[model samples]
Target chain A: MAHEVTVLTAGELRGLVQLDLAAVDVVERAFAALASGTVVMPPILSMAIPEANGEVDVKTAYIPGFDGFAIKVSPGFFDNPKLGLPSLNGLMILFSARTGLVEALLLDNGYLTDVRTAAAGAVAARHLAPAKVETATVIGTGIQARLQIEAAHLVRPFSRVLVWGRDMAKAEACAADIAERLKITAEAVADPARAVAQSQLVVTTTPAEHPVFKAEWLHPGLHITAMGSDQAGKNEIEPAALVAADLYVCDRVSQCEALGELRSAIAAGLWQGGTPPELGEIVTGRHPGRCSDDEITICDLTGTGAQDTAIATSTIAAARKAGAGSTILT
Target chain B: MAHEVTVLTAGELRGLVQLDLAAVDVVERAFAALASGTVVMPPILSMAIPEANGEVDVKTAYIPGFDGFAIKVSPGFFDNPKLGLPSLNGLMILFSARTGLVEALLLDNGYLTDVRTAAAGAVAARHLAPAKVETATVIGTGIQARLQIEAAHLVRPFSRVLVWGRDMAKAEACAADIAERLKITAEAVADPARAVAQSQLVVTTTPAEHPVFKAEWLHPGLHITAMGSDQAGKNEIEPAALVAADLYVCDRVSQCEALGELRSAIAAGLWQGGTPPELGEIVTGRHPGRCSDDEITICDLTGTGAQDTAIATSTIAAARKAGAGSTILT
Candidate 1:
């Protein structure tokens, strides 16, 4: 008989200690294992569902290298407001590889994904961003913007955080929350251009189809982590941004080409050279990272199966140690 | 705040009272959606990981029609002792196409998978098998064989069940268990040929490297559901059986080519004039099913993603209704 399964509710996940800085370490470790080919990573399979005058996208990726699957089910409704709920509600499954057991149940709907994605930002910063970066500018003041602020602080202690959302009040609230929680000075900027210009380390977390950040806003030695633009036809950075960068890195080269900032750059014939080094290759020391202090670097993270597996596995272990789950045998 | 998540353990799944044949209904619906081009089902992706001295295989499939993934993570350890554990262990994820929300988590490990596979058998029988079929024979006496029996009972009332295994005692014990639980008279047959020759409906559920049942054993007006031969070099029915059958159906053409008994038949040039209809195609009415009672139809159920999605969704819903999980807020 198997032990009782532990259920981690959305409320429970929210109440659990924010896995901010520590989660970065966990993601990094998982990537390192992935680079060494120690992790079991599965491919991403996606389907497009055409319903009555509408379509929904469903994608599933196996991260055996991490031992879990990150399934993204997104429904596009032109009338989401009429439904009184957000258009997107996603869930992830983290199953154990050892015994083929589902050790932990994560029911954040989408909160866990947002938080873990922010945690990835922190992980990328520790490895790619410059040390002791003082300022962080985040585009988009949605739920992810707040998380990016908290997660960015885990790697670099920012004295000021500038945010730019579609709405001024929303951005202001995001900055205010970060300021109150982390004791960092937070300011809402009127324009994305100004926000990116103000900070040496900029994070783009918007769902804008148009280019929100331009090359003119980027400076030498600045490290930009493009957090949004995860799907096709969604781009947050200008094409010039790719041409201006001295170094470019991506989570997965194939995926980034189809669904990240690379999509726009490639479409504009700006991505002339070979594919950027995989984050794993950089972590494994196969490719040099940040060759010069003055060279501008950009890390494109569209998210991958490896990250989902890592976070899910780590959370299960933590939940078990904390006596957080019940065991029931089958 | 999100609702408290319910955690359903394997024990809870085992203790489930209403297994809700609704999953069977869901699969049936999904198949109909499939043939009409209303459903999009992609081919499965498989990755082989070579260990220090052994190798492990990871198989993944996306069923757009069902909005779910059926992932199988099984050990390649063909050398391990059977210590009452099946070699396959993994959980299926069911994502709601309506909201892209994961509606349920079914942690049957492999038990749910076994039942679902059997349910597929039931699904196949509803469409392909002869109506009011009386005699049935099961090739192997493993746990999968038990499921096949139970699932078959759902479709046709078999007053007599013939069982055969490598070991005579195990086969007799299986017959005893079936007789006690299903209240049907199950008789153990000493030889595989006897079991196959006697029944109008036959299901082979063994992990044999070579064929166990010969073409000579099969009679006219028979329906053979080849449940085994899911992997390369694992076959239960002879290639001659393919030549003898008047109509043939498979789960997925690409998958069957690599792992099912279809591999051998295809290799031997036995798949001559007609292309075998997919089980989904038959379910969706794209292809004719069982035209005549004596048509000698055969449904090769290698299993597919639709089955997995249906079961996972149904299991999770059942778990939730029973209050089978605890709440953990993160």
Candidate 2:
């Protein structure tokens, strides 16, 4: 019988060791596959579930490049502390369309979501930011903000890291945690502007409805990676910051127009012709990255299915090699 | 530190030892969840990849009820013989949207797909078909045909099964397999008309462009379940057969109108109703199933996200309790 199955549970998946570098590398290869036209990735379909307090957002995306989908299902700002968990929790699935087989299962518990987001930052830094970049500033102290810092460190080799959050204690704790875990010098900055001005590379990760980072503090040689503002109503950076950038890159044009930082930029009359190329175009070598060292660059990642596919594929392979799960036949 | 991920692979999932009955029970529970409105299901998106010979079809469904999406990515027919494997192979991912965590990874290759489909049939049979129905006539000798038989047997005590296919040997082989597997007496019939004429319940599972069974062969006290023809340019039962059906049900009106057997029926100016009630409505008692035992009943399954959500949730729970897979946090 051809009807055999393998089953993997969330608890089992959560028990394994983390492979950060491997995840990044897998994302890199996924981009390659995406550019090779082997993958078909569609933008995620998101719907809002209204509750008594706030609403939950459900989004699903399919990446043909890696033959799977990374579906994000999470509640947003329920405001009930007793829930005692992050609003987002879901898994990634790697399915082989060739045989109509699901190849892998990942119980990320939003961890891989952060990993993929971080990996995207790493990719952006690898292609768009200068090598051996020293100082970095991270705005926002949420999970994404933390991941962006780690991902930027992976690619740019930063010696010092600075974080700014609305809560001073949270920011201080975040900086301390990073310093202890990643072994990088990290400190909390009181002013978001000061954090922006202090570093050559700035990473913004927040859920602000308005632009938290202004344009005036941006430097000429700075490379800014915007990881927040994935939702339609959210944005982290001012439109003028993008206007000042020498080069701009977007994960998906349609998505960026609807949700990413590019939405505001376009709303402010940023012409399409003058806009930066898509990330896939850059990955495919159809365009160059960071034309000049002094040129300000911005890479807007609202996230894409290609990255999910890549990460899911890699995770499944690694998990399989480690002897995970059980098999049953129907 | 909290943002670590664990991964599970296909091989590891293969080590899972749960049987189909357990999966069936889980899927059944999911259906109840769906009927209760506790499940949220998203739309299905399909991308077609056309090659030199045939094309690959990728279908992605977001099951909110189960808090994850079950994605089916399978290749075109051309890849089957060349690869020495079935054209359909893929895994199901059960993600918990509550915490943004993937709860289970099911690698049934497409076995779970059939299980879910069959479970849906059982769900339909539970609500729609006559309770004491016995004999069932199954057209087409594919995986779904066997599943329909099994699912029908589970719901009702079907002592006799009539199998019909284009190839007599294949049909006979299917009968032998069903007899051995389900412990029900089955016979391969050469004439499609004879099979349908002799049974109280009928199911069609084929990739035929035109319907094979005729309207005159169908009896008054009968129930027909059409599982094939999920895309355009595909169908099985004749339009006349639908005209002869007293009560009609479908998974989704939009999907059935575009791709299922309803497409042809709609084209031929069949019933005046805009769309049939969803199977969930019937199961939930919002809509009536069969009015009378003598009334001809039809349930057209184009598939739905709720079913995916249900099956995925169950698969994860079983995998977890069985202690399946090794985890790698990335």
Best by DockQ: 1
As a whole number from 0 to 100, the lDDT of residue B244 in candidate 2 is: 76
State the iRMSD of every prediction, in order shown. Answer: 4.7, 6.0
DockQ of each: 0.31, 0.16
Q: Write the per-residue lDDT of candidate 1 for residues A1-330, one digit (tens) a residue.
A: 454455666665666636577788777765666566555444455454444122344343334444444433334443444556555455555544434444555666666667678887887777777776888898888777888778888888889999888899998999999899889899998877776666778888887899888878878768898988777878988988887888888877777898899999999888886778867777778888887667788888887766666666677667767876545444
Per-residue alpha-carbon lDDT of model 2 for A1-330, expressed as tens digits? 354444455555555425366667777666655556556555555544443233433344444444444434333434434567555555554445454444444555555666877888888888887665888989888777777888777778789999998999999999998898789899998987877777889888888889988989878678888889888888888988887778888877777888899888888785454655777677768788777778888888887766666666666665678788655443
- Among these predictions, the greatest TM-score belongs to 1
Please write out the lDDT profile of model 1 over residues B122-221, one tens digit for every residue: 7787888778778898989988787788777777778889999889999999989888878989989987677666677888888788988787876776
Q: Model 1 in CAPRI terms: which quality?
A: acceptable
Chain A TM-score, each candidate: 0.87, 0.90
Distance from true location, Cα of A201 in model 2, Å: 2.5
Give the native contact fraction of candidate 2: 0.17
For every candidate, C-alpha RMSD to the true structure in Å: 4.7, 5.8
